[model samples]
Target chain A: MKFAIQINEGPYQHQASDSAYQFTRAALAKGHEIFRVFLYHDGVNNATRLAVPPQDDRNITQQWTKLQKEHELDLVVCIAAAQRRGLLDEDEAKRQGKDANNIAEGFRISGLGQLIEAGIEADRLVVFGD
Target chain B: MAKKFLFVNRKAPYGTIYALESLEVVLISAAFEQVVSLVFMDDGVYELTKGQKTDAIGMKNFSPTYSALGDYEIKNIYIEKESLDARGLTLDDLQHLVWEDEDDDWAEKDSIHLVSSKELATIMADQEVIITF
Candidate 1:
């Protein structure tokens, strides 16, 4: 099976991010193809490298960064949502006259069109949101 | 091939950002020329309600944007009847949304469909892709 994933909550404030991560892992474990993971709403916060947690706790952004590295997953953060939430990439930050960019490794900022294309191409579009 | 795409809006207008963000996605997807349908369930039905004045709340009044959806060439709008009844709302409470048919000399037609849960289930089951917000 081929799947496109969209997560719509912030990483720590909600469990949707964790659930989406687990579901992506489960799908990959079953040898299913993940077409893309498009983050929107507060979900773009998951791509912020500025998130720091206690040593014993899980680092949500790192987990996704590692998974993306291993699977070469196309992790996309919606540019409109990201900009609104201040999760900017280097280019986006520069374009917006910001001083810093917090986009984590393995994640890219893009337009909603990528999400629409994912829905068109993937066999199933799974939304992990509130 | 064009796929059957359904977007499910399950939240209210101002209390949460889901409704507006979901509308953004739907509007952007219109450029793709896909077969799209929208279902308003739960508090989402409030998004199409008439007489939304955001002046007191200091928020943008985006309720009128629902009427412009027909102009985007994307016109399927489904309102869950049970949800409406649960909220003490009826079809009359919503804005009169319509679309034009180029096939019939651009005749105006009703775009809003008041459907029961079972009817929505059938519409949902037939979709190739369903995105819930």
Candidate 2:
């Protein structure tokens, strides 16, 4: 099955993000095709690599980056939500005249159209949030 | 190919960004030319309420955008009757949303449908893609 995942909450604050990660991981392990992973609202916070957890705790952001790298996943962070949360890439940072870019590697900033396209193209569009 | 896409909204406006973000996705969905529908339930019923003034809250009044959904071909807007009754609201509490039927010489018609939970479930089950916010 082809799946498109939507995560709507930030890491640590809500378990939805972690569940979304686990679901995506399991889907890929089953040889299912992943259409895309869209991060919206506070979910865009997952794109920021600036968060640091305790040494023994799970690094949620890095986990996504690692999974994205291994699967070559098209992890998308909604640009509007990301900008509101200050999660930016180098281009967006430069365009908005910001000092830093904290978006994690392998996650790209895009518009809501990507989410719509995922709905249109994927067999299932699974959402995890409050 | 076009698919039946349904957006389920269950939150009140301003308390969280989900309501606004759902509308944002709805607008974008129009470009995909799919059969899209919206359902307002629970506190989400408050989202379609009329006379929403955000001046004190300092938030952009996006409530008017619901009025524009007709133009985007978002014709079916299901409001849960149970939710309205639970909140002590009637159809009059929400915005008078309408759409123009080109086949009928551009005559305006109501777009909002007050449906029972069973009807809402049928609508939901008919959709190929369901995204809740």
lDDT digits (tens) for residues B31-85 of candidate 1: 9999988999999999999999999999998888888889988778999999999
lDDT of each: 0.93, 0.93
- TM-score per candidate for chain A alone: 0.98, 0.98
- Best candidate according to TM-score: 2
Tens-digit lDDT track of model 1 for A3-64: 99999998989999999999999999999999999999999999999988899999999999
Q: Tell me the lDDT of model 2 at A59.
A: 92
Q: Total clashing residue pairs per candidate?
A: 0, 0
TM values, all candidates: 0.98, 0.98
What's the CA error at residue A14 for candidate 1, in Å? 1.3
- Model 1: C-alpha RMSD to truth? 0.9
Q: Which pairs clash in the backbone of model 2?
A: none
